[model samples]
Target chain A: MANNIYIGVDLGGTSIKVGICDENGKLLHQMEGPTESEGGPEVVIKNIANYVREIVASSSYHWDQVAGIGAGITGFLDIKEGIVKLSGNLGWHDVPVKKMLEAHLGKTVKIDNDANVAALGEAWGGAGAGIPNLVCYTLGTGVGGGIIINSQIYVGSTGVAGELGHIAIVPDLEAIVCGCGQMGCLETVSSATGIIRMAKDAVERGDKTSLALVEHIQAKEVFDAAKQGDEVALRIVNRAAFYLGKSMATLAVVLNPQRFILGGGVSKAGEILFAPAREIFKRFTPEPAQEGVDIVPATLGNDAGVIGAAGLNLHR
Target chain B: MANNIYIGVDLGGTSIKVGICDENGKLLHQMEGPTESEGGPEVVIKNIANYVREIVASSSYHWDQVAGIGAGITGFLDIKEGIVKLSGNLGWHDVPVKKMLEAHLGKTVKIDNDANVAALGEAWGGAGAGIPNLVCYTLGTGVGGGIIINSQIYVGSTGVAGELGHIAIVPDLEAIVCGCGQMGCLETVSSATGIIRMAKDAVERGDKTSLALVEHIQAKEVFDAAKQGDEVALRIVNRAAFYLGKSMATLAVVLNPQRFILGGGVSKAGEILFAPAREIFKRFTPEPAQEGVDIVPATLGNDAGVIGAAGLNLHR
Candidate 1:
């Protein structure tokens, strides 16, 4: 019999990505549409509904060949109920995303955290592809982590596992506060946003460096300047990499993943970021953990979320 | 038919604990023997053989009734080969614990890290009994942890899952160096030794407290003084709880275990330690993670290591 196709929905804040994936996770065809997120949950959900319908109709494939729909959404998901318990990005709270979409499209639907979906994507089709057990950290605005064990995403006891960004890396409660409103989370020093903040602080204090030349600097600007031999930029990048490395090393000792795949925009700097992170990772991790671990770049790149969302069909 | 008995051997640096467990993880009979560990691995290995044989023979439960032997030894085990890759405590490196034990005991042997064994114990019969997922934090001389998902211990790609002690809760490198030789580990703040160090620092700085009356100022002394409302002791205890709670919160965000089981001698302070830790954990953890997630006392106490060792039979 022909293998069943699965619909993977990447429901983001600004855009909704949908893909037709086979049981083996091969993307047969894909489609994208604006989330219309500012229109609130009702309009955004309608856009998602239209998005899936269009994917099915526009693709050179048959609906009968589809097994089920697996949606990787950004928000708090009640996986068991397939509900969006609360979604900050989509501006939806307690929206029954899976049931509404499943009812509209007349099919089964499964929903999960986007970061978890990205992890599933990496685990099933990217750097973590061949590995059944691993964790992926996306070093974007904040550090996002995903865990896969026995070829399945671990959602903890109540459906939230792999939120590494919120972990308190620094115990100094008074010095810095995290996005989660906690003090001294790992993201304060390791994330792209955090890196920018660190660099901005250094520059504003009248430190002489190439970064001072920029009118308004972002994380990538620091990376760009670092590439051009900016001492401050270099220091900024190294500091970010240092903490990230420390974070990964600490994660390695705890989770002991075979590979640490770095994804998101900042990861594109490639060897520049990875090199220093590796050196520092070795310095922090113990002998046994460092012995068998490999620090690798993410293979899926930007499409990881979409691909990972699609991979969910196979498990369903 | 009656379930066959399983032999569980716990090889610690100071002592060797063995148990005869049924399929349900109930210990049919148990025994304790001196490891005379400093007597070398050969002697330790022999003691394990003699101990198991002695238990099986004395219980009137014939050797045939005993299934296979699962040993949780103190070291980094090469799971596939059943070799003790390393042990900082036992001064062991590259020792074939399984092969030697199998030859002497005339049975197959399964080997894993001791903490992993402790996790298994809790999962199968102790605090985590009947629970599908949990993170066990053993607060001994140093802090150690094990992650159990779906009743099976997660042994990361490199077999190092649940080495939570090594995760960095302390941000700076020079603050405290772990005996694992890493800097600012969670163990540095939460471990028994770390607690004593904190108390000593307070005393050295002339903090007024009931704990100053003690000669050596151990962790328990501080806990007792803190219970009596000693300012210095309360400060030290609360500080330790903050780090511990932060660590637990970080782990809870990532692993999302059903329960955070606090074990080992330090945990004996009961609510004096757990109460503040829970408060900090709740304060630090994000939504859904904090909901229904529990920070409970370890139920199995010292027997956790032996019982968890017993869990290997069912896990494999």
Candidate 2:
């Protein structure tokens, strides 16, 4: 049999995770190694190539069975050319990932933003599998988004479409500056940073709440407090859910995805975040747009990037 | 010889415009007639079919040369089945336009929201022709939007995608209720209604401005007054541009379109509106997303709807 396997690389700052997947999008074998960024782009590229080779070499599938390689990278990139324009985490700029990988391994190479790859993974193997149109949100330190249209990542003209977190949903009086330098972006109030900021502000204001007693507050603590019906925590949670729901309403009209997959640590807050957000989504969106749409959690967890990266050959 | 002609119908409350286009998207022939909606949905459907047949008969092309018929309509619809779910303009509900038209004319039929059709028209034959990814904004009494991805209309999961005007861009403090029943939508500040409201508010507040001297204020008067250096009018115009620009910035990150085509009467204010909006778009959008994007006026004007509708069969 022709090596029907594909290699997937998830390039993070600290580590580079590589995996082999069959044609059906199932992850069969995986391995990881340090990125060694201090050794520069050349060393990192060599490490990635070595890791891919080792993973395939160690697997039952032969080299000929390896169909292609795909990479999921953080930050701005020229997706078609496989150039990492900028990655804050890896401290890379204009690194030609595809050309290098192809030269080393003699195979077709594809790369996309990490967020987009994760969404593709979910759409391929997780909650949104088989759905033609879906959007995924990673609600971690920041809110990141990916959009799939007709089963392909809808990278806009500049190859940077699906920046869903930056959509401005807050009205001006209550709006705050987002890290992207815009005012009232969904990320400002709905991301993990936003949730923590709200909790800290509540504590700083000396609100009579159980959250005040926590030695070091975090998003989990806030969610736990809200689950326990702590008034200040509930208010903060509601505000976050309100903006998230409002943004979903806006997105419901724009992309009209069949389902919305929520991921990342903050999303682990579960129903406390989802209930209010879903209610608000129904309230703000028109009935036609809201019909058949769903909001659900992601299933792939840390493996989404690698699997999605592997899927780039078939999906993107 | 095979018929390459496509028929387009632009259905409105007061009038129905029809035209024929070749495969190249050139409008070969055109005509207009009253909708007579008071005669009800059956009469309206009959009139549309009659007009399409008559136009083809009168044109150089024969009926067999007519490849397909497309209609651009207002309000909610079941696009997949060519059913007009509800049209406030034509007083229609559950009108089976595609089935009726197809049954009458014995040809394939397609339909879309007027805004979406207008966008497809621009993308097919007007301002955005040759560009695969674009967004169109119609700045009339109320704002409307359409999105084109890979030369096809992105009609979301429920055929209501591209509701750009409803994107909540304004901060809560300044938001007014939109016609769609949402609070602080972009339509509340950026539409012609929004412009006139701001001008009227200025005059009612006894502010010093050239608009105060006009017997009756309108969007044009407000723009002219702004062009004439009326401080109050300038404030009103700037606010409208500010929100329009802000919304574009939000969309830029989400869709990353190559071009933004602005149409409708309000957009005729030209630089007075576009200059500020473009400035704000640049300020609000990140550098990567901002690259190579242009904001320009829509070219087709009154013919956009018919041309866009005609394009649906080929593009959609």
Candidate 3:
């Protein structure tokens, strides 16, 4: 019998990443292409199909060895139906991604939201490897999450199970309206945007801080300032970590996952952000739920999406 | 071949309730006996075995029809090994229940925590029947929770996945210590114990209310007073309902279960409790997650425990 392989596509607004993974979820080969999403879903999907074909053809493996194809899409997806209900990033709606990609590549195809795919990738091939139950938090512009249970992505009744960012953690008195129109969401205080907004609010109020000296305030700058012992920056960083840790404490009782994997750019802030979150998680979570659980950083970096998407064919 | 039947044991401190169920999880027959817990694990095991034999012999079915036996125990348990690690109610520690029961009956046996068992009962034969994913809350002395996913109890990595009562939902400012040592837990505010405590606090503070006139206030008295338009009692009920609704909203984005099943004595308050909780769940949950999701009462009541135990053999 011939060895089987999987093809994964990480469909982004600007560039689409493609990778080939062996049965063990190892990325054997990879390639990328321009999305041209403005040309619409048809063009973007065509680019994905071409890149997949090119990657497989370039590798030593033949088309027959490609067991299936899966794509990690950034949008509200009808995962069961393989439809992209709405994708603001791609300016697409109601696109039958699986059908179109299967038609173009003549292979079985599956699609899932980006957060879920990335979490699966981490579980299958990255930090969460060998762990059947864990949660992955992508702390970038927004706080995205994925719940992996028994080595599979846990998409709840409405395909919205792992929306950790939207958890209403902040008390109503201190909360601001989130882009999702909710007040006091975890994202409203923990996301990069939230941190920057807090820093901007501090500066406008004339608080004493070195961040006032920076021309542009990004999450990285705030972390750097906090590392330099800037009081205001440290407060902002702690505030972000506070809600994150509190949310994890809630998840501890609800899911009791064995591990929590943090990924994405904000997670790159490292110990400064992690220390406070860990402390708060310890303070809030009960002892039994936290006994074997540990918080760790994601290892796959930018490749989690493609790797996880490839795993969809196997894990799903 | 005769149709197979399952025996379920609901082991409480004072009494042992046993039932027989068919493959479909219907409770065909039930009987109860004194636990005599002071007699220790051996006596309890013997009683369970005798009850099983009696129920089978008394029924129209033959002894050969018994497929398996399962017990729902209230305590810390090592589910996989079927050991009662520490059951405060049973005064048991490190009792290998599955081995003891199997030794007597010569049949396969399984055990799970009471909360998970009750939730499974609701999922299999009551309110959550036919629903693949739902969450059940037993609002008794303490708040107990069970997560049902894909028609089975979702016990997390360490078998503590559905400890929803311990969610740290109350904000720090208004937070109180929980029995589990955590502060601001949902159980501290939403459980019957919590409601009774609030009623007592209101009376102690000399708040003008009818509850103060009652010599001893139970959760029922508080609910009854609130139904008659007592402002103090209404405030306590609403507070309890508030946290319940908030926790459900949190579970909405985390688990996205299709239905929320509320059971136990506190839930019997009916519209006064359900109406406020439904409104708060709607107020807090995001539209997409809340869509198609409904909150309803658990229909099985006390029978949920036995039926759910019977289902352990099938669902586990």
Candidate 4:
């Protein structure tokens, strides 16, 4: 590895995690702070700066060895221009994030959408290591994806690449509404909310299961209940797996990725999630693609974000 | 611009089209032949050799100046090995096509899946020219795709990259059975055969429309009838477009493509096929991608296969 060190910042809706990393993609030090998103972009920027400063101060390694800094924030972005074009929850439109951070820190900064950065993190040092082409999808409050091809991120002609959550896994039939306000999106059916929606729908229709008797429930409750042999919860998780597997099969035909690493909060359901998902994938994917494709659970957990973000800085 | 010439061959069950071109992708000559696919792999090899000899005899270009030859065939493949691993339609399996043809022609030969070659042709000389990131989908008897990134084909770890047809567009419960032995594949609902299948299903259910009374049904026939005010046919075609559009939206996410070029036989339906597809695309795709992505019809038409194959030679 080179002698260079780098900085990593993970910008989430409620908090920010900042860290220092070596060129080999090792995290050296870390710091965190509340995003105070309601206070708006300027406040979040200040918080990000504070977090970065704390990491620099705390690291045993000196700052002079750092090459630059990178941030992973949720939004539509202009990677080439170093701007956050539109982030819904953040209410940010065309913010010159790179220049602002560079101005404050006196160091160069590279900012990418959080999902994109997470994908870069995975590709560089996490679950996707050594893979030339892959897609990392996180099923959380919403769905997000990162596309990596030939060891580099595929940022598209524009920067809005790998938005898998918005793809119409279901189309025109009045399915769940995606955050983008579209109907029948893969997001509506594959995320945690989607899983709950499915179980709730089954109950409303009088499908007999243990979940039908539960007080309000979430996707995790469903997965936990499924592990305990709840028919309704098991059914709901299975439904999500079916779609997730189908989506992977479709993804296979488009990108022909050698590996697919599933992560995020909902992925914790484990084989109750992956087993059926893989079964459906084998059933639905074209024969040739099914031959040797690897569908693995993401090795990185919560650390994926901070670690992946750090990895991004070192690699970039 | 180089003086070196190349030959491109497109192999299908019933017929084959071959073209002669220069290194810059300029076509110099062409020929067509019956595939005689029933004659088995050995006989087909002989036919390919004869076709190459005929092309050489008719060309004024010097044989010494020929750089290489390429072939694109309809089958699952081992691309790097230049083997046709399987073909349900043509009954081919594990045939060393490249070595046989290279030896017969006394020059190097390369082979690729037909869809990949089509994408390559567009990447080198057609609509996707000057663009390295693109997804080329063929709406033929089945939906097929090839991904191009950074001015070259991305054939995944197993040479099965770009299998767009097999992506499960419909959730299993709501999906139709695809010919590839699965439920709800994009190809089952979106290709030329897929459109006809839907039309037949719709008509069988007793919905009155222009196509209900037709003696023969084809994908184009349904599209033409729908144009003249047939409710059932219109519904069928729109439904197919809906699935196709949604699938493309998913592909946009999966591949982060700069362009989505629709080709093959059914694309001839034009706006009727594309307009609704565009609507679904815009509605479901995330912003930036929704605004920036291009869904254009393929430009090479029938000659795409040959040209694309030639491109494979020049590129791979």
lDDT of 2 at B295: 98
Worst 10 residues of 2 chain B by lDDT: B166-175
- Which residue runs of candidate 1 sit more than 4 Å off their true CA positions? A1-4, A13-15, A22-24, A34-65, A88-93, A100-108, A171-174, A195-216, A229-235, B12-15, B34-67, B86-95, B99-108, B197-218, B225-235
Would candidate 1 be rated incorrect, acceptable, medium or high by CAPRI criteria? medium
Model 2 CA deviation exceeding 4 Å by range: A1-4, A22-24, A57-65, A200-216, A228-231, B1-3, B34-46, B62-65, B198-216
User: Where is the poorest 10-residue window by lDDT in model 2 chain A?
Assistant: A164-173
Best model number under lDDT: 3
Model 2 Cα displacement at B161 (Å)? 0.5
Question: How many backbone clashes are present in model 2?
Answer: 6
Residue-level lDDT tens digits of model 2 in A1-316: 4648888899999999999988777889999999999898999999999999998888888998888899999988989999998899889989999999899999999999989999998888888888999989999999899999988888899788999888776766788898887777889889889988989888898988898898888889999999998989999899999988887887888888899999988998999999999998887776767889999999999999999999999887
- lDDT digits (tens) for residues B1-316 of candidate 1: 5568889988877888899887777777889988887888899899999999999998878887767898887766798689988887788989998899999988878888878888788778877778898888888888878888888887887787788888766767345778888777778888889899999888788888766778987888989998888888888788778788987887888888888888888999999899999999988887767877888878887777777777786785
* Tens-digit lDDT string for candidate 3 (A239-302): 9999999999999999999999999899999999999999999999999999999999999999
Candidate 4 lands at a TM-score of 0.84
Q: Choose the strongest candidate by TM-score.
A: 3
Candidates, ranked, lDDT: 3, 2, 1, 4
TM-score of each: 0.86, 0.91, 0.98, 0.84
Candidate 1 fnat reads 0.90
CA lDDT, every model vs. true structure: 0.81, 0.89, 0.94, 0.80
Give the candidate number with the greatest DockQ: 3
DockQ of every predicted complex: 0.66, 0.59, 0.87, 0.57
TM-score of the A-chain for all models:
0.92, 0.97, 0.98, 0.90
> Candidate 3: DockQ?
0.87
Q: How far is B304's C-alpha from truth in model 4 (Å)?
A: 0.3
